[model samples]
Target: MTNPTALELISRSNRLGADPKNTNYAGGNTSATGTETDPVTGEEIQLLWVKGSGGDLGTLTEPGLAVLRLDRMRALTNVYPGVDREDEMVAALDYTLHGKGGAAPSIDTPMHGLVDAAHVDHLHPDAGIAIATAADGEALTGTIFGDRVVWVPWRRPGFQLGLDIAAIKDANPQATGCILGGHGITAWGDTSAACEANSLWIIDTATAYIAEHSSPEPFGAELTGFGALAEADRRAKAAALAPTLRGLVSTDSAKVGHFTDVPEVLDFLSRSEHPRLAALGTSCPDHFLRTKVKPMLLDLPADASVEDSLARLQELHEAYRADYQAYYDRNAVDGSPAIRGADPLIVLIPGVGMFSYGANKQTARVAGEFYLNAINVMRGAEGLSSYAPIDEAEKFKIEYWALEEAKLQRMPKPKPLATRVALVTGAASGIGKAIATRLAAEGACVVIADLDLAKAQAAAAEIGSADVAIGVQANVTDEAAVQASVDAALLAFGGLDLVVNNAGLSLSKSLLETTVADWDLQHNVMAKGSFLVSRAAAKVLIDQKLGGDIIYISSKNSVFAGPNNIAYSATKADQAHQVRLLAAELGEYGVKVNGINPDGVVRGSGIFAGGWGAKRAAVYGVAEDDLGKYYAQRTLLKREVLPENVANAVFVLCTSDLSHTTGLHIPVDAGVAAAFLR
Candidate 1:
């Protein structure tokens, strides 16, 4: 069990970090000085546990906290009159670790040590940074919090900064907190609860201060004339254009993903002054590490094809990368470690949305979350007057700092499907969700396409890291929406490798009871949806001259006759035959086309979510509860056809060495001979 005080400190840290407005992804740290038994001496010694470097304080655990000897850290807190002792202080922090733990303490460990209090909390809260970055930050801090807060001017976080903090705290013995200009805020007290209270008080009071004192938005009126994509067209265009933008930023082929529609993010980007503000720079030094000192604003041509956009994006990327290196060379101090590459983490693409880049989906998500907060702070500071943070020279030291770079340099190598991209339709539930999840697990970036945008997003969130699964709203029958879905796959991941056509519906009715509407619903969704998605996917596949896979989810009724299932049977048969022809046309381009015929899959699937299972069971003269077992008993193998069973078959078709096998149907009905092909 964690010590009660330590637990409170961690609890406070996590709660603060959980909100991006407070601490954007791994941006803040916390520490608590407590007594612990020495490993060799077996005597109680004061130990300081600051948040470990590079880990998100929001999700931090016991081991994630770095334990340091408090006395040793305090010894290094004072900068000897004025020599360059930053390097020596960093080494001292390393030497002070009390035991076997190798996790490095946060860069601000020494400052936390000199707090002379039981708890110390440092956070880059949005409101705090907004106030800190403003031209009149010092004046505002005094006006907002009065005598309780000490204002520390802009300084590199090192021994000097620690000395300054210690000196200020000594001078103002009654102050409860200190605001680090162009950086963040620190609050300390005798107890964890007291320090946390002070932190909240500071944030709340400053937020209120800004709300009342800040000037009116400068560009609010100019937004009326901004050239932008229509809301109806943004999703499709964003999807289509994603690949080109991704290709521009990709160093190798790890698929780049775009995250859009976060309410706050959208609200910020919609501001007409965003381009100008973003170009100014990040509000905090840590954000400079997440995004960059210079923001890359990508222009989307009004009417450009995927090919044309890719060409244009390539040119932009080259210029952006070169400019980044020049900025780095200009500001990099001697002994600062070289960054891996000059790729921008968050790139602004007005009229569509800003995109966050990283090696994997999670890192990209961090970039997006962090940038959203940074933008809010930027807009807030600008409203207060003009946005200005630590300039490029100050930001350079933080971005390329040896300690910060070590965190990102720790990720392992990518897996097999790291470069591949896939689109799964009807992915909100059941079979489609299973297939999409499997694809993500195998390292393929997946686009979750469904009729309901919310459900699609929820399904994607459930599958894996938010970046790997993108939700796209597409009604397959609509040619435009289908084209958009295809574009979404290419645009988001830079290329396409697999297309899973699983969006479908069925109507239960007798020959006389079957209305034309019922027939159209089934036919349009099954036959036409597959046709549209396949047609769209095939064009992209053929254009690249790269092999791909198109897997269609058909029904067992295609080959096996069922009572009161005419519409489903006929349209499914249409799909089965269409797959054969698609194989013939697409096979020349090495794009394999195959079909899976699955039996009843009722558990937690959308097919049953709307009472379709109960209605279908009634038609079959079986109780709703017995529907799955009743269907299983009729099959020779007497096994229920789970959604995962169908997913496994689809995976085999897409990934198996049966490269020459196409235009064939794989049955997922537990040995139902009637559905078997001759």
Candidate 2:
């Protein structure tokens, strides 16, 4: 059970973290001092509950709080290491734990415990940062809040910075908060509610000041040809450029992508000062950790052709990599961790939009959001005075800090298909849905492409959240819709890596009973549809230069010569050959094409439920309910094959064991002696 004060602290932290105006995601810390009975001593003791390292305040829980004894923590001042040896203090914090520490203490822990207050909040709100980053920030602080909010000089967050803030608070008895130069803000109160109000007051006041003083064009006048294009044009251009950009940024490793052209981003990109400000990089330590030192600007006009932009993008990417390498070499010390990577996490195009990449989708999205925070800070700072961020050397110290490296190393090993993206057609129900669900479970971002948009979206939601999967409308028979589905995969998850051409229907009609329409309908949806989807997805896979997978849900009828199934069998055969042909061609580019033959996936199968089951049961002279058992009896193994069985086969083909296996068909038919491949 949580104490009343701790509960108030949680509530206050959530309210502050929930609003972007208050703080960026995971960019702040909060704490409360309270009394709790010691489990061993059974005596009331003072404790400090502060937001821990690597935890987001918005979603923080009990486990995310670091528990320390106030007496032990405060005693650190006696043996306090100076700024030069502050890194050691972080390790020493573990010794101050009151019990099983809830979480590892963050570097900002001292600021909360040492300050003379019962409640403390450390936040990187854009409004406060704007004043903090201004060239004349100290002067601006005095002007804005007088003695109420004091100003602290720029110091990398450590034991010493906490000491500085604690000393400042002690001297200024009337102060509610202090603005850390070129960093952020810290507010305190004797009570949790008072602390929250004081924090909000500081942000709201700073915001109002910036609004009153800001120039009409904080980012400078709009660049003529670089302003945002029409909505349609911007999207089309973004789609065309996404794959190429994804490939470039993925050189170090594959990354999931997020694209946004929100007014704030477009407004900044369109301005003349964007290039200069972007070069200066983000000020807050939290911002740069995810976004890298700086972003890669496209350096092209909004109206430029995609081909022209793509050509220049390659050139710019090379330069960006070289610059990043140099930045790493310039500041690396004897004990600095090895260079993580030379890839740009965030890419900015003048007209189209911004593309941010990460090992996964949510991270990419959050990185972009953080950059937006930096833009807001830049805007406010320029309005007050020249924007001056922390020095580059300081950024290097934080970025390559051993503590930061340890955090990265602590991340769990990625799943087999962790960074891969897959698109499954006809995924609204049955086998297709099963395949999409299984792929998502294995960590592949999935696209549920189906004719029914609503059902597709519902399936996507059931399978996972937006980052794990998305649903898009696609009619395989229509060439445009097929292409759109492939494009949707790229837009949603960066680029397509696996495509399952599973959109199909069955017409269990004899040769004599089949009409031309039946033949064309089956052929168009299964045969031509596979070809169309394959071609569209292949373009992206090839451009990504990251070997991918394309699997066809072919049938045993393709080889077994099943009776009363001319249209269905012939279409399945067409799909089977397409897999072979594509594998031979796409193999040079590392895209593997394979096929899975599942015999009579009747139970839970959409096709079997949609009229085909009745027709097939009639031909087999069995009741519809008994058809599955009858089919299993005829197989060599006599085992019933379910939708998940087929889904499992698809998963295996995409795994590393089959990396070199392609143009081959694996039967998920529970064994069929007659349908053996010749």
Candidate 3:
């Protein structure tokens, strides 16, 4: 860690005596001031402060502290066959404090030099260390504090551990502190008091849980496996078993521990079935991030060959990998990113328990935590059941969502169009009704334009007052009627910012059997009606100079080419093209034009009547009962294209987020386009 400033030093010293975790420990240290000069950046650094040797923090003074220049100490760690002799290490520390002829610095100076945080506190709190070294410490910690604490798998302290902490801090920028698995707890904060408080809180929580869960004697019968092996042989077997166990579980096993000594460990390994032993962990989720879901359970055979054991482990790994992949594949959506390069599995050396691995410390911690929680849950559930988390497809959607990805892109602060007014045509029911509802919800005063006078008034009443909503009857195809609708909107709301061209008719008929009148009626409502409404709205929008939103409700058949629906399809296609040209012409005024093409909008009025539904279904060679299912299955998301979904698309385009977007046609078809391509 870097050295603290005068203010930081005072703050740390004050907290040192107050923090119970630091009792009897050497006085705390600080990092150097000024910028650190490194090979990467080569900048000047102040100094590094470390706890002085052989002094208790509970009663310490400034003389008990060791201050060393950060740059010189950092240079030492980079050297190969780094100085190992105690005298040499002390000499290096002295040079850091007073040049080549300076006083001696703390022995922990090298470790402090490696930390990234401005402040780092290392304590060997008795309670923390005692609990940490216990077999089921991680699980116990989780049952105590839940999401508030982070756990690091056991690693030898010094440069490597400091580097690991730096990585963990980077990944979890919000963590209050960290616990070293099989070691002790470390807390960090912007201020010394905050850090000290966090440390106390963690210890207290862990202590409470331990007091409640710990037993005078073993709570469950122990299981036996590897107690017979010699110490040297046990260590070698455990080291070799790490990879094999990891392979069996499809997780990283480098972090797993294989202890050859200790009564609890030995006794647990002696039993044929390890009961309470199943619940052990280094820490909670934070630790699991490094370790993975579960450790390898190793049960050594008295006469079994090491090769056979390794092979069995390999088979287990294969089985786990296959199952994990299957789970991921089952829940994943089309075009989603793969969940993991390899399965996040772990092996438990029966007596040794779990371990984890990652490309970095954070990854290992995350893997370890996940494995730990899963094991606790599994053990609690007993062998009759196990946790089957979300499948890969669902996970992929959440992990690789376009919306989530968009959040990564730079964006300006959002501004609300609070004073904007909107007019939605054919607002009495169906897609138009949905559009009207949505616009109102977005704080826009809306005029529900419909040809049905009574239904229009009723819809307006349902949506509330004229300030936020008004019902007006106007035949969308009639030029005068369209003008009246626009005049009403302007009169009531002052000016217009949006116009939803949702009034359209759907008629199903083969070209030969279709009457000219039927064709004209369809075109009049779907195409000509759109022109009248748009032409009327564009005048007010252009004059206001405030820009605006124009949304056209087109059908998927416009692109898919449905049979026996020639007139409706052609008119929809024309409506879409109209949007493109409108967008081009309106760009100068900052007005946006877009369209939503929906496939199956169930529960709409008139559109599904007149045998049109049956006729359309017949064209597709399926009964009406299966239409929704067919459409859903064909879609990549397997979701119905509801009117509400189309409305959502219209609402998005109408908002300021798309202020720069224009002349676009977004299909709210739930991956229909991709389905067609497939």
> TM-score: which candidate is best?
2
lDDT of 3 at 381: 25
lDDT of 1 by residue, 483-561 (tens): 8778777656556778998998777788999999999998999898999999888877765555789998988888989
lDDT string, candidate 2, 210-274, tens digits: 99988888889989999899987888788888888889999998899988889889989999999
| Candidate 3 residue-wise lDDT, 220-318, digit = tens | 443334444665454445544443342233233222111223344444445544433343432322233244323444455533465777777667566
lDDT of 3 at 59: 52
How would the candidate models be sorted by TM-score, starting from the highest?
A: 2, 1, 3
Query: lDDT of each model, Cα atoms only?
Result: 0.78, 0.92, 0.59
TM-score of 3: 0.39
Supply the TM-score for candidate 2: 0.98
User: Which model scores highest in lDDT?
Assistant: 2
- Against the hidden reference, what TM-scores do the models get? 0.75, 0.98, 0.39
Candidate 1 accuracy as TM-score = 0.75
